[model samples]
Target: MTLSTRPPAVRTSLPARMAGRLTRLTWIDLVVAAAVLVVLYVILRVGAGTAVSFNPARVTRVSTDPADLPYYAARSLLRMFAALALSVAFTLVYAYAAARSRRLERVLIPALDILQSVPVLGFLSVAVTGFIALFPGSSLGPECASVFAIFTSQAWNMTFGFYHSLVTLPRELDELSRSFGFTRWMRFWKVELPSGAIGLVWNGMMSFGGGWFFLVASEAISVSGHRYALPGIGSYAGTAIAEGDLGGVGWAVLTMAVMVVGVNFVFWRPLTAWVEKFKNEQSEATDVQRSLVLDFLRRSHWPHALGRLARPAAEVLGRAARILGTDDRPLSVDPVRRRGGDAVFALVAGGLIGWGLLDLLGYLRDRTGLGVFAEPLLLGLATLARVVVVVAVATAVWVPVGVRIGFSPRLARIAQPLVQVLAGFPANFLFPLATWFFLRTGLSINVGGMMLMALGAQWYILFNTIAGAMAVPADLREAMDDLGVTGRLRWKRLILPGIFPAYVTGGITASGGAWNASIVSEIVTFGGTTLTATGLGAYVAHATERGDYPHLIAGVAVMSLYVVGLNRLLWRPLYRLAETRYAL
Candidate 1:
């Protein structure tokens, strides 16, 4: 018997082998090259379309023809990814600060609550004009504003997830970092990042899907008084709706689903599989996750060859990071000194908050007097009732389902596309049918509003639950199974506690997202009819449409006050419990 020593090769004729020898290109190389070129084409076309669309003197209109859906999908996807990049950057900085510093945590968390509660229209009302002024006649201004709006939809949930990951960082990892004498930067970049990676990726997927509805809405609803849409599928759908072209609208939605699946396949599925490298397990997952794209990349020659070429550069950068990271000792602060520092920070933060409040009050008083506060406050209560109900229902439903999916890698892989499609499918995609049902069934806007908000908000709970379930140690899972843990006993003894921290993060963010969604949910218009629910969102929407800036400001302020107070009263305590009792 004889064994071949050459690298794996596909069957080929003698002439093909001769051609490969002469050209220095194997069949595998050709296939890899084709794949690389296809990826590059998608990237370059997306970038070029986005760049050219931001012309100051030009006005772009969305095309509704089904044939144009592919191009529109590309543009919309580019915009969504741009917003996602911004969200990731913001989460890294903002969440890190909140986790590391007690003083900053107090201020930043509440600020996050308020920011998450502010709806898309509220953001656009301020951001659109400022972006236009900043860019000075460049259409890039409105484009940037649209990205920011989507960014808002994503950033807070991601930030909360990362922050939870940090605060609930496993004790073993912390001890290992201390034992290694790792510098702060090294600890963060190497240890903390991998620890949080799963949570961040899960939350990022949730945010992407959750933000899609806003992507479409932001197109038609960017400006206060008039429509300012960019060239994307969202705009295409909005244009169709405005023109009453049902066929065009249906095509736009089909295009959206395709875009979501494509992104999941190429970007997220690969990343999800790659993160498995960071898992801490004595035994590997029984059914390993797979991505065809990831598998090909690992098997290909070009990428590994490129890595070898870039090794020197990578080493140089690594050396630079070490040189820049001067702090090597673990963080240890004196209790008294920490308290003093917190006191100083509190005074400064309080002064800034106070000044802003006074300014807001003066604006309200001068415009409509103090009596104007009564309406928004009462309306806020209505919205609050709706939010509480939605959050409760979502938590009860998704927590168990997410746990089951998370425990099985095969199940998780299968669910990714289906979940993304569900999360990304905007409620308004079915608004016409819903409107007809609402009228036929005699359903009021109150119930309809709750349903609409859930479409966007519930995913936060599901994603966080999945992340939490995955975070449970492999050894612990095995022990539970060995002991014959099952059903309610299993959930009670292992599952609930393990996922508690992430569930808290999810619940808080979901609540805030529901509040943010109110603007869209509480006000419905279809078939030349308008249905307004008695909530804070309707109040804010009506005020914005009327160009009542001062009133809009008041409405936002009241909404923020309600959200902040609720967080202080409820979610924060649950988070503290997660930290003390349930953290891995």
Candidate 2:
């Protein structure tokens, strides 16, 4: 303690002070971080730039070569980031609406079902035309098509994750927020969003993998007789496949694997760690809420600045809340002013759909005649065949494992990320490899397609099943234990029934993913041959290649309509069964 008094006589060295400061800016660390940011910004700038029309013929000609690898990888990374921005925007709105309104949940859940079920090729086919029309005079139309393709791949899982988190609020968590009279915005940010952390993270991971499933079609743009490819991983792979270059495929695969692992480490890991920190630990009392950021902010300069600004912001938000008719009262045990909500929602939805259809028909008549239309019966069969095979395979693989892991929280946590990593991996990376392996072995096109679809869709079953399994009541588990219901009996009587809701949810989501994946899966480029099977996805893919806008719209419309009708007729009833039978 006396050392300070004696040390006052001793002067601190300037060199020591400078050395300490310099240590903070370690050359290695500074360079690496700065380099990463610079690289990322450059990639983003290029991605957001105008589309480059690299000749498709040249791409085909040089398919298996290693020359354009860097050019293509850079391009794909840009598109991936762009797709990410769109996905986040979509997730925010969808999650918010589903959280806020019951009627929206009803309409949107079905709509999402249809959206997800419609194949990616169908999306590309229709979206390519609509997007082209929007930017009628430029290459922007092709870029828009590519962006939409990415959207189809990534949007569904995130939407479901957000939706699931909103509706599955723990009673205590809801009550705690209500007691504080948190505003709708505060409730969403502080409560619903946090609750959905696991789901959102899971979805983000899945969306990344799902992006891979569509990379080929997104990059290798073919409209009518004109084929355009922007340099990206998909384009590179497509070229590699065309030329039968094993080395290029191998390089792309290695690069993709490295990129996936690195991204997960940097972004997903830290985010997961932060979320895990917030997660309620078993030993911690339920009432305690330790918000690390909030605690820091309370003591920081920003909070004081924010405090000065709060009143004006509050007033604006207050007025908005009043107009929305949301009261400042505590959470009601019963419903609050629920009348006419459904009717209003229904009217709005009907009005929008009516407007959309009329506009669509008008555009159709002007652009192309009705004589080119394909019959609905054939479309339906094609859709059905794809759905049946995907569902069957997904169920068989994910069910038992999902249930097993669901029962154990530790296992579920570990397995969840593994599944996510698997989900994010681009299927295109595998196509060349799969093509190489299958062609030499003489496997059929159908076999390869099924494999591709299965890769994308299987995670849905696993994830949803785990969610359902975790939702099972502890008391029920205890009762089953007491009754000596073990092994097969336990699974049959307790686990299956307990997780039925999640299974249905998983099945619906999986079916959609499978359909989306089928486009690329059904069409294979291997050993200089492009192999395709007859399916709605194939039809849509062909139409997109042809730049046949009318046919494209018709194909997408049929698929979307089929998906919607099927959900209403089949999955809706199953969801009802789960809600009534299992929901508390």
Candidate 3:
């Protein structure tokens, strides 16, 4: 046997080389970028009343009536913008740390695990007081707090996506960066961030949906016996639900669907396509090959001037590095160091459990004769029951369907958009049909509401599992096929195991979404009668209506504890399985 080795071809023509060197960015594009920045600044300054006198008093009154739709819409848009910026920043920071520093990765990643598991309501309870105090008599502070609540709803999915991308980069590419002695900052910008782009887009889409799920509670706050309603889309939804107006709810749903579609078409599609161009299949750039960005910088007078200035700064940095004997070698790693990771996670879990117990004991002690604690425990049980039913049903239906879709790319394309539209459909859109069906069939309102929660949460598992299934290596699939795998045997032997990690990711997110959606789902009203389920969601909704703080806290606490416990017991194990079994 003999082995043959040959050198690869390189570009010969100057024009062909130049065309490849310069990425095409027109002057019009630069103008557009500048215009966007200018317009955003102007809007933030004037429309938001931030740059001028900045008077909350002069910001005009916020009416609870539907007549104030424009006011609330504008506020919601502002908060959405803030949420996007914060999500991007946090994702970059967390993803970078998790990728580059093992010690920081060990501590922060698990803390993020616990933080993400905590509900948006739980976040509000802890932060609302300090957030409000930040402005101390300004309405803007409360407004910003609402934005932070939205941030909590959106940030976690993005963090996970970025973390996954960071850990999963090609080893050859990582080694290449080390060989070149790329600076930490250069590696982050040129390598890590761009590699994470596709995952970030998907996570960003999920996070947007997550934000919408909790919009109602995030904008409306109740703490320490006080009720504060900020102007936003959530308040709009809450009002429509309260008034039993199907038409109004329909309008809101339409607006959301339009926004989702527009965002996907305008932003996500192009971003995905661009990222795909840089995947591992793409040819590597050699040093002898010219880059357009470099050529452009060389030709431009401004860049030449900047380079002249930067040379001295670069020299200073180099000298400092030499004097300090700084090494640029890549760090060696052992996955077994995750043992310490598990210990840190256990400590956080123990603390949260202890806090919940203390609160429960205090409630019992303080309300011995008043019977206040009774409602919370009963409500907690009802919340648990609803979660169990919805999750069990959702998983049963979505898991098999997801595996099929994953195996067929054409099916996945069709199903993905349909799932997106379905997920975006608000619970209120189905309220009329649900109310009518329940009334006609004499079914309890509770079951109907559970349907709404399940509708939203179920999709997460299906889509995520499908993503996981698609990730199964072609070699593995071919091997199974060659072995004559079919039907249940295929699912058991190949498909289920392949997509289990994605299922866990989806399930974790969906479970949290169900908890948030339940607030709206567990309470039903058609016309004159309001049917309330025996759950924390119903309790909180009712309390919000009557401005009852003690009961609201009780409901929030009950819901948060369940969410935390489920994450620790169920989702945590699944996450470990994914990391160990399927993670790249």
By TM-score, who's the top model here? 1
Model 1 residue-pair collision total: 0
Ranking of all predicted structures according to TM-score, beginning with the best and ending with the worst: 1, 2, 3
lDDT of 2 by residue, 289-359 (tens): 22333343334444354577987886786678767867554443344445566667789899999999899
Best first by lDDT, ranked: 1, 2, 3
C-alpha TM-scores of all predictions = 0.91, 0.75, 0.71
Candidates in order have lDDT scores of 0.83, 0.69, 0.66
Residue pairs in steric clash, candidate 2? 63-239, 63-240, 72-232, 209-423, 209-424, 212-426, 224-546, 224-547, 449-521
Candidate 2, run of 10 with poorest lDDT = 284-293
Task: Tell me the tens digit of each residue's lDDT in model 3 across 35-97.
Answer: 569858756653564222223333333344556665566566677667878998998888777
In model 2, the Cα lDDT at residue 217 comes to: 70
- Candidate 1 lDDT over 365-449, as tens digits, reads 8889988878999999999999999999999999999998888888988898898898888776666656677788989988888
Model 2 alpha-carbon drift over 4 Å, by segment:
1-71, 125-144, 278-348, 355-376, 403-421, 429-448, 466-486, 489-502, 577-584
Each prediction's number of clashing residue pairs: 0, 9, 2
RMSD of 3: 8.9
